[model samples]
Target chain A: MNHVSDHDADHDSVYDGLLGGDDSQWAFGTDFEDPLAGVDTTLPEGVDGAALAAYCLMLGDDALVLSHRLSEWCSNAPDLEEDIALANVALDLLGQARLLLARAAAADPSVVPVLPEGSPVPREDALAFFRDQDAFRNVRLVEGDRGDFAVTTVRLLVASTWRLALMQRLVTSRDAVLAAIAAKAVKELAYHRDHAARWVVTLGRGTEESRRRTEAALATVWPLRWELDRTHEVERTLAADGVAVDPADVAAEVDVLLDQVLAAAGLEVPDVKRTGGLGGRTGRDGVHTEALGKVLAEMQSVARAHPAGRW
Target chain B: MSAVATVRTGYADPRAVAARVTDPEMPMLTLADLGVLRDVEVEGPGRVVVTITPTYSGCPAMATMRDDLVHALTDAGWSDVEVRVRLHPAWSTDWISDEGRQALREHGISPPGAAPHRDGPVPLNLMPTRRALTCPRCASPAVEVVSEFGPTACKASYRCTACLEPFEHVKEI
Candidate 1:
């Protein structure tokens, strides 16, 4: 039943010479095009590059961390349909993360870790893999483990709603690259939000057990929603400069959207205290939950081990 | 070079050759048919540049598309070929050509409808995508969604209630 060719019997591994045997081609493939190849990446006039870079990292890390979590649900989802759906959502977010991280590196190269010479690690890869836990800027909401299906669904619903709102306005960003990124992301986020919202309703209105678990999951995740809208100083600067959407500005909007989804699901927003970080510090300040360490450790293990090893 | 020399030099039209490059994921459609191939410019006798846009931010097919364009143009006699990606004016399903639509239907895949027109904020609708689509198999309008996500990022899985056959629909973004 093995239909695969055995022409390469001399090769120890089946994939030994995959993609022309170039090890570098194994990871991203040879002649990999830069995601932002022809896009203009210059900073807006009088805008602080460092702050923009930081802002990009904040958004990029959010997508990257949450994407990793979602991808973990690859085969573990409740059904085959749900499994493919989650993976698709993860892929969309991962794409957004790559572009944002690449933009961050373009805005300020200093933020990119100095990898070994001839490492062949792209700028975005270096930022994603080389950064320590203390350097990630994602909100604590997205860094946690892949909770139960209900938990994941609720978190996704909230996260996508917030992100969709932000991206809608980001289409007008002064920075063309960010604007372009947001324009495309807005559509994808809308789909992600729709998918999550539907699941939330299904879980809420399903059996009594499903409803109970959905309620419990909401309570578990509702606390982390606070950090999502809490704008960082970098975001404020970029927003003032018309280079970013102020997270605070979108707070009321996100709340209304979430309320609508919950209402349609015949569920109420869970009453929970806001999750607080060390006095005045939070994920935006690189103050993440302990869970982020585990997430990064798993994500960075392979790339860290082979800093210069292609593929 | 003289006009006769130019024709004899194996200098094929860069745009024409680049336009024939099909998408790696959806082989039924060319980059031109998918509207991903934005523009092509002949810099000199042997140098050419091709510009393309991604269907999605994280579309894995983009890398393949770029590679395919280079290969196609190179094989067509362009020695120095550069593929550049443009992000502005993001690619829309509306850009899929009429020919592309026919090709999809011929291959038992439903073509995308017009993209959602967003005048302001994109509204949150939990209902399934409301589109007028028929089963590519039996031409039956009765079909139900199997899943919003499909084997590829650009498609959605659905089954025809009439023919009882499964098919993929290119989702409108």
Candidate 2:
């Protein structure tokens, strides 16, 4: 992705068109730098900036990739309002990804410090140039696959519930940035969970045909739950420091919610069966499905093609 | 009277001026009515800084609102304006003031009463059940959710049996 200088005059025109008139020109930045720059970062004492950054990247990448998948359903949704709703949800997740990734980049010592005097690089540039999948920290649920609306809703229910739990815990993090982001994200994730749960129940109880599909979708996505609860050394450290939620603590809550949802829909929860155990936590390790590559390619395509083109 | 004093303009206070900006999602409520416009400071000459936070981090309407705010203030002749987005002590449904709540009730949308039982860390033993919604129109607690998702992401469709009317209930986040 090419970086555009804040000084370009044409940038203003295009932005105005997108935003409608010159009314909001003040809300955006002319500096063309990452928005997270130089805002008094306070990391927990003794925590490793690089590791923290990598951890954040894991979560951010999960949101980014899943958001991309959700966007594919934009105009193709079953109804017009639903199309708008899905797109809105996707954009919400995208906004979360942008903030998380920008925070990760800011936390990295290797990346230039985001200070008033320092040149802060745009998040797009950092995302484009930074580490690959091996360094990502997202769980398998977000990166696995986007099957159908049923599958997506199942995944969304589980992921959003778990994230809401995590975000609730994160609101009290010793690390201010994490806490602030969590504070902002908790309500949004709550809505997300409710939205997904509604769909899961609707489809599960709607018709025999729909119920079968919903159950199958739940079964297909169940295995990924293991990845969601797995914790690594960095996670453990952060958990100890109150900067991250213990994935284990959230597992029970997530299960109870899922079980209730499934029961309400009259679908039986399938017994857990392990598969493809060799990836060693694919998401946290940055060893993702080919789906991620395809997603990144499309996401970065426009910015890459335009380079520094205005708007 | 002198020609310079020919016209007398009514001057409205800043609070009254700021109250004219409404929430994009909840058209029935203004920013002041919703407690979103936390602070408005007129500093320096014609420069105004409005501090606002989003109801949620990814609310799509925020971008539109920031534009609306600038337009409202600028068109009112406060051109050197700055809009600051703050995320700390993040927005809560609790922030909706009593006035805002009353406005919502008057607008035929039920306001959030208390935090939902599903909002806690531990799952409630109760079955996933819908609570009795209070009718915004009649203040009668005989409402049922007709649909889980409503007209917008923040609302749920409801039918008030007492009033024999269909209305939207602002879902508690």
Candidate 3:
């Protein structure tokens, strides 16, 4: 059991009262009934709700799947300190995923993946733990195994860097909710990017083995990284309509930022090839690499097995 | 009970009521101290509108905060209440009031030392420990980070080497 303080003091502001303990359900890892309660849920004029829902899933799934992957390192990270750091990062992504999934549901209820009836899980949890592999919209990069510590760091650096760039642009979105979410989350994403960047730097320059592992990690992930930048047809259309930021638009910024981090870390940007093929389809099209199925199978197993159980 | 009748029967100003609604999670702080009591509007004689911003996108206390505001105002005899959440100009720890800082200290939690120079420059992060956080309990600079992620999203867990006590510090976001 963790020690939660009982101290409570009266502040000058009106929002003051004393809870006996850290009674916040979220602190104890419980979801609230509705995260979007009193906010106006109206879409901006001319923005398609269905399309907006689709757009939300694109971002949400990325965070959701990656969050799960990172959670795998909870007890398995190389060191105790790093175990907490990685889990914290995973929780941050999980938090974003929860919001994005909830937004998607609020935008269009049709987007909710079918969960077993009478399930007590929240809408966001349902989408996260119930959906099949092909239904997930995250990029192929985050779906793969947590290779080595070096691999995780480099992959995190690339993904978090790319996300920061997108989030920076997203703060100006036409959709007020989306813009608000981005604005609040950008700061978090900045920390995430910096955290990964520092690790990549340490690993790249520490010793011969670390340097080799970092380089190897970069090489392994760099080829598959191209898929993250390719925009889906829906995303492109939404970007044109001013509802979403196209994935392709952020590529330059991501590239420049990664290059700087890589150079500073004494690492090289590996010569990775694109896996894109006919129809320009990528993860955004409900298409993903072969690894995603195995990821989903493990992620969904517990929930699927015990559909009525509550965490 | 004597104060209740005088205050609740006809307290026209909704801010007074809304401000008193403590954050359910961090009980010592109020929405005003937290800098989230953005605006309170009196639509007509009895109608009121309140605006708030979340400290984080997935802040669970948001729903509780909204409900608390509505209930507190309604109990104060103000009908037709609307609580709206504003996301633009997102909430930051920097927005936390001085009174909020003092309150956090007294409640055994450390207020944010400084806002992370978020968009300042790329190297700000690479620089060693932007600012050292003092332990709220012992006011010692000898604290170490126990965990980057605390019990909740907006907090980081820290332990004081001086007092050997663990506490939560609001992380700059």
RMSD of each: 4.2, 6.6, 8.5
lDDT of 2 by residue, A1-311 (tens): 13455555447455456645453455442335333433456677887787777767766777777777777887787776566666667766777777778777767856422222332446535574344555555676776567888888888888888888888888787878778888777767766787788788889889998888887888888877787788877788888877777788888878888888888778888786844445565567766666666666766666554444433
Query: Where does candidate 2 stray beyond 4 Å?
Result: A1-40, A78-85, A109-136, A198-206, A263-268, A271-281, A309-311, B1-19, B41-48, B72-80, B102-110, B116-143, B159-167
Query: How do the residues B1-173 of candidate 1 rate in per-residue lDDT, one tens digit apiece?
Result: 79655753788878888989888878989999999999998777688889998898888888878777777777788888888889988889999999999999999999998888888877878788777899999999999998889998898999999999999999998
Give the per-residue lDDT digits (tens) of candidate 1, residues A189-245.
888999999988888889999999999989989999989888788888889899999
Model 1 regions lying over 4 Å from their true place: A1-28, B1-8
Q: Which digits, one per residue and each the tens of the lDDT, describe model 2 over residues B1-173?
A: 75322321222345556778888778778887666787887665566777777665556566666677767877776657676766676766777778888888888788875654434563422233377668877878887766544556566567888988999777665
Cα lDDT tens digits for candidate 3, A134-192: 77878888887888999889888888888878887887788878887887678788777
Query: Relative to the unseen true structure, what is the C-alpha lDDT of residue B19 in candidate 1, on a scale of 0 to 100?
Result: 89
Q: How far is candidate 2 from the true structure (C-alpha RMSD, Å)?
A: 6.6
Provide the DockQ value for model 3. Answer: 0.28
| DockQ per candidate | 0.61, 0.27, 0.28
The TM-scores of chain A alone, one per candidate, are: 0.91, 0.83, 0.86
TM-score of 3: 0.79
Question: Each model's C-alpha lDDT?
Answer: 0.88, 0.69, 0.79
In the predicted model 2, the residue pairs found to clash are A58-A137, A58-A138, A133-A286, A134-A286
Which has the greatest lDDT? Answer: 1
By DockQ, the candidates rank as 1, 3, 2
